[model samples]
Target chain A: MTITGKNKNKAVVESVAQIIFTVCASFAILAVASITLYMILSGTPAIFKVGLKEILFGTVWKPTAAEPKFGILYVILTSVVGTMLAILIGVPVGILTAVFLAEVADKRIARIVKPAVELLAGIPSVIYGLLGIYLLNPLMYKLELKIFAGSTTHQFTGGANLLSAVLVLAIMILPTVINISETSIRAVPPSIKAASLALGASHIQTIFRSILPAAKSGIVTAIVLGVGRAIGEAMAITLVSGSSVNAPLPFNSVRFLTTAIVSEMGYSQGTHRQMLFTIGLVLFVFIMLINIALTKILKKGAAEDGE
Target chain B: MGNDTLYQKRKRPGEAFLMAAIYGAASIAVLLLLGIIGYVFFKGFRVLNPAFLTTVTSSLKGTVGIAGNLLNTLYIIAITLLIATPIGVGGAIYLNEYAKPGKLVNLIEFTTETLSGIPSVIFGLFGMVFFGNVLGLGYSLLNGSLTLTLMVLPLIVRNTQEALRTVPDSYRSGALGMGATKWYMIRTILLPSAKPGILTGVILAVGRIVGESAALLFTAGSARILPKLGTNLVENLSRIGGKILQPGGTLTIELYLQMQNGEYEVAFGIGCVLLVIVLLINLLLKVITGNARKYGKQ
Candidate 1:
């Protein structure tokens, strides 16, 4: 009778512990749900007040005028353009660097280059902002004076503009694309390379035609990740993109979706603050789409590896 | 003749061009890294001194100090790690040790992945609204700490889960065979074995906290004042405790403000300090994990 009671007590304690653990493990789900819920609850009312068409498609963004306008079409356009440009510049360099590390470089060179890339990844975004301000801005300013010196248009062609933002973003996205692509290239099967070599293909030809084609999914995933980083980035772009809402010309100062929310969050109130949250909602949806793509690609890669 | 011709095939111009391009790209990446580091150090080293590290900002004295921000960074780090570590480790334990393979587990894992991918600016927005306004913390260090806890929790959980998986199953069975409860086995055998990983996660979280600016800017209002400690030990302790609920800026925010104010030299100094801290933490991580690897073999 005593032994049976002891066993029952032990079982009871064990079961209670399990219950506690289950609750703890659920915190991730809880956090995600709460963040999503909070964002939607706070972010949607502004969309209704501003009207979806005016908020999304309208061009003006006069939030504190006598009659307020809350259009984000230009902001969205700038983010897309800047990100697209960053990818165009970053992808080729990143992929080429990865190709060097994976296929061409000697071991010593690879070792040195690898850690440098990791360090690049670890540098804080603010530092990137600081560098952009200190270095890229001035260079662009001189270039602006030269290019538009004799032109008639009165443009504020200072260094801190869309082109500056694009350059900084391109550099920032390099580590993400390079690291992922390098790993994927390394994962390519040796047998395929051997087959190509046996078929009288040169090393470069084999790498381009066989290894790269085989690792296409991973390289695509890397590019997608780079695009996401470029679009979502705010602080560096905020510093260099001049924080003005304008058409995304090479010389014109432009505000991205991210910088728009951050630049005004401090002073904004009422419907204006609500609009910032609405912008946050838009950014959230963009991120969610990227995350979904990442997950799908990763799953596909894993399945392919399994086969 | 076929074998001889195949062996004697000359390198094509295209091959040479591709290789040169590859090398050029690699060189450019390395040069960029070196240039940034060299430039920061060259400029920052000139202004870095005892006065800058120790003093507080004084417009009248024409002096700038990051002492308050330094302390605030430490406070935020301590508070964030203290809360995040236990909760994170607990969650990992439940996921790795206790939970059965099922929908709930997968759901938790999926949510964790989703949480990590959400950008810092969004976290800043949420913290500004939820923590700053709704919680009535009103842009305090405590509010920032709470926000960061949420941000770093997934990182800690992922690291701890990875660590727990590395523990040999034999160790668990051995502890349980000796009449120990499951919790006892975990506390004694599993945790000790996974110490390196848990520590790594915590340290990496510390690095993230130190480097963080966006979330803190909203949650922790960038007040540059030092916490007012009284003239006694007990009073000072209470004052320090009280400071957690007050607005404070950290090093990164200070860096941002300095740059904004055109305090270029001071900003570079802070940047150098940040770089040094990152390097040190990375080294410490490597040492700890190296030791852990050695211990694992035994």
Candidate 2:
């Protein structure tokens, strides 16, 4: 076709449209960059002022005491243990459920169970909080009373403690684990299962030996995502945990990194406020680490699949 | 029994045990949902009344209700979607149709995933700093919606991308062969087909915004009152605009507050309302996705 004035106009419009689209696409990058920059800007000043050791190692977190101390050692430990424990409880049940959905369940059962799982996933975190408060906390308090009967550990804040938080986290992370794990489990090559079964392996053996082993990377990713979910959980945790910065004993009222920020951000000012941002920064670092590890696992999985 | 077991159909104890565990685990997931939903509906049923649904909390009249919170939640969902959908759709178009495989494209995709992974609390904190204070929107519906816009952007983008991907390449080729421009092909063909998926994404985003609380806590000050409005038509329209700038607590935030204030009755009621809303959302999603699947086959 011959180049003409109208054609030039069309060419210019296309390029301009492309530019606008590119800018639109870059918004995600812009958002991530700004979040990181702001986090560093707002979070680092507190770290420098408080000394990283004092903040991370200091056990006393009396932010509003006569002489305020801003240690988050207990806070860090609570998050670490809470996340780990939740992972332990959630992963098994979640993986087994995935196996059922992917390998065992009939179509009718899967159809019924699938929507329920999605609804569970859809339930608000705060509703989880409500459940924790009413259902789990009371049961925990009764258990605590029995276990610590005649002991001088005054059970304050009812049953809101580390254990309750963990249970809540476990339940909350279920949807993530089950969905991702199930998808990966289904993606396992049918040939692998067939081969294993043909080699005189039982059906259960084929699933455990061939299917799960093949789907390990996706399962691992699901677990990592679950950890991320548990670690950064705020609303359900804030309501469930006893909101005090304590060592993460099973029954102690404790605070996770995310809850520390949410509980204090409302009224906190100056250094107290900035330290809350520091907690966010700490939480951010943990999530980034998790994200990095996930990338490594996924890349390795892909490379292995290639081989 | 030993040699025949290898070739014969035999069940190991381990197999039975593993099978039991799988069934049991699936049951737990189902039970948890049933238990929570059942509990909320049971508790909230006692407290829910027509009056409870229709009025705001007024100390002078001594009426406590979630009307204000319900409205605020509706408003936030509307405003957030308004801001997020166009940008998200545009971004997805760029990703799926226009952009070549390159560093920038990969970076965008990675960031989108990261955004989804990032917790709401961080978004709340960032919103409190940037949008709430520095941007001078303060703790208002608009400010909260902006924060939520970021939170739900990934949903829209990913869903739109999936929808766009499902569109056959032949449509694009045919359009271009007919001398249509790239933008024309996308506008006339890709987007219309992608509408169902985009709608699904929007519905999902709505569900998220309805459920979200942590992000709104600091960014949107939890003021549980109806915003002021004008009486006359001209003034009423202007006042609706004014409502956008006022601080309002959504249903979830108000639920948290009620829980804090030891108002279990109200809290349970709010949770029940939220559950019902969630049920409705899931139903909508099921309908759209089922329709999309049916359409896909044809």
Candidate 3:
């Protein structure tokens, strides 16, 4: 074939290939677009009807009363408190565990523990729910009784409460925190550790002072990831969170944003159901905010690594 | 490697406490894992009789089995994988191989990362609204599978992109030098070399699908019966096609429903099976990656 004819054929093939690739790539775009649109379109009406301020900041959530109140303040508080507590407990434990695997543990132990963490991550949230229901709730119930035995002022709980949700959320988030923290800790340049040790700082001091600081960005990224997971988690929390829309006291049966939607979604209707979608919308926005933070932190971490 | 001596003098009080705390944290994690696995198995094993595996759950018969869920789980996995693999792999190829390093690639990557970070419950919400109601698939296995296809698409693309990147540029150049078309070269050389990653990605997606509950709940509905397989061979073949369009519950969904109904034994049994399956998948992943590394070294 002539060179001109061959070039034309090549151009045709290339364009065809490009079009196919573009179509495939569009799947991601389409997924994001459709999800956002659906959530907003379906989730907005209820918020408008309920009055945005009342739905968002109101303390009452009697969606089925003769005169229903749609305040989601308590649910929002429960989710925030639950996520914060999870982060508080989960971050320290996860960072310590990551340090153990990356710095303190011998290779064989690290090898074993690392896979266990991965396995923990792989366990379904539903199984976590199962465990939470069977194990954690009962334990929490006993603890609650013991703690509040003399206090008639405190509410009685059967153990499924915010505290139980926090505990489960903490455990659920460990995999993300540990994996990222360990990677970042290990990524801290060996030279930095050596120099710190050479300056007469003890091994522990060098790790604490030098390595942790150097891995700060990555560790921050890890925490952000943990926060994201904790806030977004639903199934496990739904099972253990005692699912009542109440103030987020440790012993109180509180509803989270995720659980609030799920517990009511099955049987809810009319404005109540629309409100659930609005709650979903709220959750989606929370997730998007977390995602933005994560992307920024990760980009910063990557840039530092490059440097 | 010689840094061991730096740790020899770590006898300070604070150092000892910190070291203890670190080890304690690691032990807690490992012990928690052991406790979870042990508890599930102990609770479940006694209930998992041979009859339990084979019988359909019947209130009249007073028997509980997950045969329907098992079959449904297999069907969902097969259908989800079938639909997702080609599109996801193609998207990955586009990103890593065909697309130039520019705005389009960046946009796709950003969107995929966003897609992944969106919680499964939101996907469940979206699936119920979009696939179930709008698409008129209405709470069927096919609807659930399509929703999952979107969820797992990012996983396959990211995995396949990583795999395709590991395929050295030399192969591409050599194929081009031999007058091979880009498609021919990718099919014959790049894909075969990247098979392990693709397979690993698919297996991981299977793991996600099997463990999934929240997303499947609304889209797949909560039917615990087997989708009607036909009486005859022709009917059976047609049944397979029809079943995908019908509502059914997989293992995870059944686990949730069982718990809701207070069937602790059945739920635990399902949890045990899920845990075992997850463990097997993790082991398979390790084995594949280990082999890949060994081969790369060679």
Candidate 4:
């Protein structure tokens, strides 16, 4: 065949290959979209039957008993409170660590700390739960805490409680906050720091006043991402949250949304399954709302930076 | 003047104390990671034996090995990588090379980001409904692999696309100028150049697949026995050919199940093993990519 004819044939083949690849890529996206649609559509009928008030506001969660109530307020509250607790404990420590890596520490120290944080990120949640059970629970007991205080008569044992869940979550999310905060702090202009130092401000003062403020948005994004992760975490929470559906009252044990879905899905029949899907949908909406809020904050921050 | 100097020096001491406290907090965070790993290793070492790696649970004694679980994890990894890697790379190539900036590409991007954000439990639900119920594959390795394929497809695509994007345009122009077709140029030039990125994606995907428990919970039913070798190979090949469905267990699921049953030592040991595998792969990829960059610069 002529060279021109061969080139034309190759172009046709290339076009065909491109079309095939696009179809496959598009199909993957469609599959995920369809999953979301299927859950929403299938779950809506149950939501309507139960009424949104009972599903969202009711306190009880007895799906297996003769009388079944599918309220998720308690679960949602547990997830929120647990995540907040994690953030409270993790954020300060993470910020300090970020500062240490970014400003206080030398490159060698930063290198060691950075990979250690990444390694922490890679540790499976199940292992975290196990560590909490073996170590944190015992430590809590040693401190005369009520971690194992009410366990004798309870369905579950020691080591599985809200505090334990929150502690583990704090550990799990530390890497995220530290990494992002460090990056943001590093991005602060060197001139700003030099100027602050030239004006007789100490390194610590300059970091807090200039660098921290400059990197505020990134730090906030890191915290938000950590919250998203903590709220959505399942296995760790399941293994630690005592798997109790009772309303979480301070030190009392509780269950989160993800835990409720995993623990109950095995035996959840009829409305129960739908309710679980509804819980997932609720979680999805919450994350999406947070993500949208985060995006808005980031855009505003960008605008301010531009100005 | 002496008194004022003394006051200033006292304030500096307090500042140094505060800095020490701040540094201490940061060090504690790093120490927490080391403490966790150390705790796991110390506890797990008691159970790290050949039998732990070789035997399958045969009786109610619960002292059995995780041989079957190990096999199942390997099988799932092989099947998932075989299915996901090529398609992920192909989709990425299309996105980087052929597709223009348009609605479809934007949709693809959105879908990938959303998929990455959705909780694993949701993926579990999707896998349960789609693979377990709709496809009628039942609870099998095929279903689990497919679920994971869906879960990691976006990640692999994004990574591969980024990798492909980083390849200089000059290479493409050079190839085209030599009268090479786009297909030939992509296959021989771009893909090879982006191999390290593709491998890094594969490594990350492997880490995820190895660690995934929630999605596999519904798709790959809690089977505790290893398939016979012949059957295993057949099933493996069929999965590669996109044909078979067999229920299997992964390392994460095994660890989860074991921990739930209070097999603490076993779970920790397996966790250590899994962590080692992941770290090894990550280090290997780092080394490979480091070398690739060095050579590329030359």
Q: Which structure is stronger by lDDT: 1 or 2?
A: 2
Instruction: Give interface RMSD, per candidate.
Output: 1.6, 0.9, 1.2, 2.0
**lDDT for each residue of candidate 1 in A1-307, tens digit (9 for 90 to 100):** 6988988888898888777777778888988898898889989999889899999998898899889999999888998899999999999999999999999988998988998997887777778889999999999999889888888874764788999999999999999999999999999999999999999788999989999999998999999889888888887777788867888888888889888877788789889999988988998999889988988998998999899
lDDT of 2 by residue, A1-307 (tens): 5669879888899888888888888999999898888888889898888899999999999888778899999999999999999999999999999999999999999999988988999999999998898889999999988888888756565899999999999999999999999999999988999999999788899999899999999999999999989998999989789878888989999999998888888788788999999999998888878877887888898998899
Winner on DockQ between 3 and 4 is: 3
Q: Residues B1-298, candidate 2: write the lDDT tens digits.
A: 4567545666488889999999999999999999999999999988899888888988899998999898899889999999899989999999998889999998998889889988999899888888987899999999999999998999999999999999999999999999999988988998999999999999999999999999998887788777566568888887777888999999999999999888999999999999999999999999999999998888
lDDT of 4 by residue, A110-136 (tens): 888888887788777778877777777
Query: Alpha-carbon error at A213 in model 1, in Å?
Result: 2.4
Per-residue error at A108 for model 2, in Å?
0.7
After TM-score superposition, the amount by which residue B285's alpha carbon in candidate 4 deviates from its true location, in angstroms, is 3.0
Predicted candidate 1 versus true structure: per-residue lDDT over B80-195, tens digit per residue = 99988988999999999988899998889888888877878888888877888888888899999998998899989999999999998999999999988897788889999898
- Score residue B259 of candidate 2 by CA lDDT: 91
Best by DockQ: 2
Top candidate (TM-score): 2
DockQ (Cα-based) for each candidate = 0.64, 0.79, 0.69, 0.56
Native-vs-model 1 lDDT?
Answer: 0.88
Question: By lDDT, is 1 or 3 better?
Answer: 3
Docking quality tier of model 2: medium
Query: What is the fnat of candidate 3?
Result: 0.66
Clashes of 4: 3
